[model samples]
Target chain A: MASFLRKNRPLLVTLLIVAAVLLWMTNRYEPKVTASILLSGLTLGALYFLVASGLSLIFGLMDVLNFAHGTLFMIGAYIGFTAYANPRLILNTLPFALALLGGAQAGRWLGGLLPARFKQRWQDSSFLVLTFLLALALLFIGVRGFNLEKLVAATATATGGVVATDLAQEAAGRFLPRIILLAVSGLFLGLGLSRVGTAEVRQRPRWTSAGVGLILVAAAFALIPIRTPGEVFLLSVSSNVRFVLALVIGLLAGAGLGALIESSLIRPLYGRVYYQLLLTLGLSYVGGELVKSVWGTVGFYMDIPAFFGGSGDNCPSPNLWSWFSDHCQSINVLGRPFPSYRLFIIALGLAMFIAIALLLQRTRLGIIIRAGVQDSEMVQALGINVRRVFTLVFAIGCGLAAVGGVAAAPFLGVNLGLGLEVQLQGFIAVVIGGMGNYVGSAVGALLVGLARAFGDQLVLSGIHLPWMDGVVRMSPSIARASTVLIMALVLLLRPAGLFGKKD
Target chain B: MTNILEVNAIHTFIGQFHILEGVSLTVPQGSITALLGRNGAGKTTTLRSIMGLNPPREGTILYAGEPIQGKTAYQIATRGIGYVPEYRAIFRALTVEENLRIAERSKGDLAKRGDLIFELFPDLKRFYRLPGGQLSGGQQQMLAIARALVPENQLLLVDEPSEGLAPIIIEAIVAALRQLAAHATVLLVEQNFRMASQLADRYYIVDDGQTVSSGQMADLVKDRPLIAKYLGAGYAGAGLVPAQSTTA
Candidate 1:
């Protein structure tokens, strides 16, 4: 009996703490309210797990503390929102894609024309600078020549002298010639830029990337005729299909951006911890600003998909079985009503957890990753390219963050502050769970989630003791600070974190 | 025998400190060549330089008659060179099977050579499912060598394989290396002069990051003054030098 107790002491202690918390909760509040709070806490925990798991994995394998992780989350939300509601915005933005590709190619071409000595000295930096200047020039031309407000007003005057949101279609049609000219100039810019970097010219010309740029230019022209206003096309598709599409697109965009960032920014700065931190922090700021520039500063809530019974004030049925047939916004859980979308969030988190666990435990890639965490240099010497694995892990981490963002859209609403808010929570969870420990992050997230929920409830309803006459209330800020307090407590007791190995 | 690997005046650095300055050596095909040096004499660094873990900034490394100095570690490994790093740098968290699995350069290489590996160290077959960390020091060394043999490597860089093992374990490792030397050329780094004299056909003495002497192992065993000067009198006094110089 003693041996068994000694073996399972950590597990037994955790259970005891949970039981004590439950006993106190049942003493102070109604069972239904407690149950409702528990459900909400789990939902919040699920979101935290999605964000924290990726952060932990990235840090574990690559030793990169990615500040831009939250930005990837925010980007996911915006991408999801566009795919669901304003998909026309994506179609209208084709010219920018063309411009970017054209500008890059032009930068490369222009860089190739520089003297060999200068090219050899500057290398990648020269091409980067050339591309940046060309991009700025293109942005200037876009803002000056095709200002949206001016075009709207001019189109209104040409049509009937009254402004309307749908008037963007006619305005865009009128500037078709100018749009074509911009695309052509972008292609020319790319060709010119390609010449300024001599290494690319000395090495073989990038026929494949150049071909992709040409295809984008062709696509820009093809897509111009079908450009419609964003809101007008919203009613054509089912919300369920749109939501699924949003999720897939959000995941893909997140992964693509992650790969791009790791290869272009983080790859060059490997082993330089401070530079990586600074670069990622700067990227987060720039990303948030970019989102604001495109999507505006105001926060917006996504419409709940019809499969989750759509949005409403009250649920029609309290029966659990009615969930299948009825279009209810809320489901009854333990006789307490809860948002059905939050339940879906909980399910998504569990599924992600299982998938990641299986990936780490069952696959050859998992073996490589596990070994990499100990000594990446050794793994590299063992005939595995650890650098490629680092990039893949980074992309996967970012993709998971984006998944969390898209999932959080309906529950918490999409906003600029959402990135920083979740990022702080994720960092706390990672620290409490133990840095780079995957399962620990999930457990830490749950603890933080539950503490926050109970703290909020305590602030709102106050706690009444058997000996005390009335309820003792505390400030709401305590609830906000609960996660940090837990983190501090965990650090004090177990310095390496709950599961972190002593180095 | 023809030389399979040749490193010429190679200079390697770890961070800012120059670890391998003007170090050079050669390994003959199908033979065990011993690199004898004291602790902190850049013996391990020389092995690392050949493996491309810390590639040399100067001079050339010719592997089977092709330059391989500037190549990355994985590239060097893929070119048929295997390394068993010092301290048995096995992935502690990985199972024995998983450790060997990761070392396979091509698919099914492990299964194809499973018989040979099991024949070499039978204990590994018994503990295949266990994590590498759970193994004893000697067992871990066996697993490390087993990992290097998984791929069809032409040359093996084995570093101090008997450093922390018991005498009995060292004898077992020596026996295993004798069997392995028939299949692949080995460049061994050993502090134990006795083991070096037993297993090596040729020897090179490195001091202060440069090769100071080279000759047949029989000659190294006979020369008492040379052994005392380079390997320290402690090694000579410890009876590491064999009494019978004509044994080899």
Candidate 2:
């Protein structure tokens, strides 16, 4: 039993803390409010987890302290927000894409109809020629016939799309072309992808497929029906598609930015701690300033998609799916209405945690990474490219931070100060969890999130004690301060952190 | 025999301290060459310089007649030179199997090497799933040697294999080295002159970061005063122990 305790002390301590927090919450608040707060806390924790996981991973593998992690997060949020705000781009790009699709189909048809005596190269050449002709036709259509303003005006006039009642019809009319265009682009995209696939096997140039994809994207962009009020902000687009697209783009953007930073800035100064710290701190400021210059000083409200937002008489969220619409309203857990979005966020966090765990534990690359974390020189001597693994780990760490930023955008809104604030919390979480420990970072993040929620929400005004007059106050400052307090307490108790191995 | 490795007048520095000054050495192909020296004699530095870990400021390291001085450690390793450092730098957190797996350049060679390693040190196979940190000192030394061999390396640079081991463990290690020398060229550095003369065909004595002596091990055995002059009187006594025991 003592041996067991020694082996799993971190796990047991964490469970105990969680249980204590839960008990305290249950005793103080009503079941419904407690549930709501718990969900919110979990959701918040998940966001912190996303950010902290990357920080821990990079710190563990590379031994580089990344202060600029938050900047990547902000960048991801901005990218996702920008993508989500632009439904018009998707809608506009649709009509011009028809020819590209038709061209690929035509190429396939020609390939099938060609004489059996023709050589494989000749058939392939014919296919290429047909695709090129169709692309040319698309270019013509884009340059001459495609006028997004005229198309929008025409749709508005013909469909009587003025009031909110006809808005759905107008949207339907706008989306129909988008759907068709998507299908067309998708078809050509598939053809291009297949070419790439064949090139991999045959050692052929995959440029033709790439060219097809570029043309398709260009055609799609040419058809975008510009909207004045709608395309300017994230709140303008309430569609689930826009939200999903934004999230994916945000993750990729974050990952890309991470790769860029690692290759350009961090690569040369791998083992130098002071230089890395100075460079990363300077980068954070530069990145924050760059964001401010581009997006301006004003904060943009992160609009929760209709499917994920509150649905009431004041602003009844109009979801295409009735199942989502049904669940969009607050879920009653005693008498209080608990936001389901928080629950969804919590679920996302759990999924991400499991995914990262599986990635680190299951894959051969992960095993190599883990070994590298322990003794990098040995791994290198073993003939593994430890430098490449370092880059990959750093990028992944930064990408996860970006995921946190984008995920938290709806709750916190997009602002210039967002990065620094989240980064400070992430650092605190790292300290609380233990430096260079992944699981500790996650546990620390959840604790911070829970403490913040409970600190702000749990009030002692109603309860009356027989022994003495009792009152406890809660404030927003207290909520923020709670993270610092928890970190201090954890440090006092376990200097190496709960899970940190003694160096 | 053709020389597999040639270190030509290499100068190495570690943070303002000149560790190796004009250190030159050669290891012939498919032969065990021993580097003999006292503590802090730059023997380890010489091996590290050859591996490109502390790439010499001035000099060239030619492995298989290709210039490898400017190459990275992994590049040097991938080119068929394996290194077992003095400390036995094993990934202590990883399992014995994982340590071997990470060292392997090609997965296809694992089973063949695994068989050879198990045959050499059966204790490694018994604790295959155990973390390297949990292993005894001798086992760690064995694991370190086994790791270097996993990549099917042509040359092996072993530093202080018998540094701190019991007579029985050292006996096993000496036997393993004899078996391994049949397949790959070995550059061994040893404080134990007894083990060194037993395993090595040739000897290069390094003193003050320079190669002080280089000759056949047979000649090194004959010249006790020469060994005493370079490796200290204790090492000379240890080196000629087998011969004295045979006479007895």
Candidate 3:
């Protein structure tokens, strides 16, 4: 029992700190308002955890200082904006394109019925021809039937005329020529990516499916008018459905981008860590600039689909979802009402944390990855491809960042600098928690979030007391610097971070 | 026997420091080759170079008649060469079973060899679920060797396996090596002359990042002056020479 206490002392201390904070808060403010503030803090902490978990994992396994992680989060927000805004259109088009490819496969299967002598030629030419025809058919239907040009025009007009004009002009200038080029490139890229599954590629059973998925992602973008008013495309999608689809798209895009970056840029820079750090820092800027170029500098106020209220008195309750409204409406703690969306975000964060924990602890891949973190050469000598593990870990980390971005989009709005604040919070969380320790990152994120929330509500704000004539006040900068102060104290006391190994 | 691995006068540099200059050796198929030298004699560097951990800047390493100096460590490892580092670089956070499990290429193959491994090191089975860091020094060495054994490797590079081990444990490791040598070729680096001479078929003596001598282990044992010249004074009491192995 003593040993158990010794083993979990850090956890106990953290709990004590949390309890003390809560007790102090309840004493100072109205119970309901404090509860609301605490809930807001937890939601923010959860979002930070989602982002920091990825940064921690990637750094732990690969020793990569991925400064571009926040950039990936920003990209995820944009992906959410593009794909989630019109979930119905993208989701519908996805199946149609897949079915067309499936039909092409059916044509190939039918070709298998031909004479044995013609088998080679049929495979070589007939399959390509069938896919090409189907692709052309998809293009025709997508462009003419969907009125892609008008969609582009409407989206441009709705947002700002300048960025849309540039996008449309660029598309119009190279639409035909670019489509042909993209189709060829997409074909090659698909074929190349398919070959990466070496042993499975030799079996060739899933090659067509792999090819279809790759081609759809790589070439399908060309068919959609770049300037399509996102909301118009999303008109038919239900709120819940739109959010889920957007989350999925954001995750996949972030993961894909991470994979590409790791494989191409980060992989080569292994064993040379400072270079990796510099390159990623440069990439973060590049990524931010690229987003600004496309999306413009203005913040896009995300449409709160499921939520009932906007930021005005017209809607009294900020509890947007029906589920929250029905369940939590009557449970006002003091003089203030608690928003349920923050609670939902907290739950989402916990779910993600559990999923990742299960993934790392319960699976064969997790064991290999954990072992690889300690001795990659030993893992390699054991014949496990350590590089592949590194890539996968990096991708998973980026995907989590995307999840954070999408989840926060409704609350914060999608903007050019979306990743900056979250990224800084994530870094501080990682540092305070312990570099490379997952649970530490989560704990750090919560502490940082709560600190900020408390700072906003209690510390920096001018506090009025009944006994005192004047209000007590602190500088805004002190509140902002509190995150760094916590980190500095942790570093000075426990340099390896709260849970870091004393290497 | 035909050579399984041939290092052709390779020069390896670790940063600005030239570690292995013009070092060369050969391990024949179905035989153990001992690379013996005094402390800091580029023995570990040679092993590391062959494993592609610190690749050679000059010359070549031919494994199974193909040049492998340019390949990454994992690529070299996958091509049927297994490495055990001098420090017993086991995953300390992982369990004994997990350490071996990660090294295994095929699950079925590991299952087949699992019983055989336990038969060799019964203590491993006793602490199968314990973390590698919690293991004693002897057990860690055993675990490191056991991890390398899981993959179906044709060539095994075992570095200083006897380092920091009791004579009794060293005997157990030597016996394990003999059993291992039946299926795969072994390239061993050892400071203990008694063990290296007994276990190795051939010997290569390295001095100042260069191969100074090469012969059958039996012939090497008779060369008192050569042994004294390279192995330092610590081995002189072991009766290899009247003088120390090295002046330093």
The top-ranked prediction according to lDDT is 1
Alpha-carbon runs more than 4 Å astray in model 1? A1-12, A94-235, A310-316, B238-248
Residue A114 lDDT (model 3): 46
DockQ of 2: 0.27
lDDT of 1 at A177: 61
Off by over 4 Å in 3: A86-174, A183-234, A307-335, A459-471, B239-248
All models: lDDT?
Answer: 0.80, 0.74, 0.75
Evaluate residue A46 in candidate 3 and report its C-alpha lDDT on the 0 to 100 scale.
96
Between the candidate structures 2 and 3, which one is better when assessed by DockQ?
3
**Model 2, runs deviating above 4 Å:** A87-238, A310-325, A459-468, B243-248
- Winner on DockQ (1 vs 3): 1
- B48-95, model 3: which lDDT tens digit per residue? 899988889899999999999867677788899888888888989988
Q: Please give, for residues B151-195, the per-residue lDDT of candidate 1 as tens digits.
A: 999899999998989988888898899999988999999988888
Question: Could you give the candidate ranking by DockQ, starting with the highest?
Answer: 1, 3, 2
Cα lDDT of model 2 by residue, A1-503, tens digit: 99999898877987898899789668866787787677677877888888888888898888888999989888777766656653333244334444445444433433344355652554356664554455445444434433444433322232222233223223434544544444454444334323322211211224564455456555544444333234333333345777787778678767767876785578777778999999999999999897776566776766777676656663322332442546564555455656566666787788888888888777768878888878787677667777778878887888788877777777788888888877877888888888878888888888888877776674423333457567545545767887898888888988988788888
Task: Tell me the lDDT of model 3 at B18.
Answer: 98
Q: Is model 3 an incorrect, acceptable, medium or high docking prediction? A: acceptable
Candidate 1, Cα interface RMSD:
3.3
iRMS per model in Å: 3.3, 6.3, 4.9
For residue A47, model 3's alpha carbon misses the true position, in angstroms, by 0.8
Predictions' DockQ, in order: 0.54, 0.27, 0.33
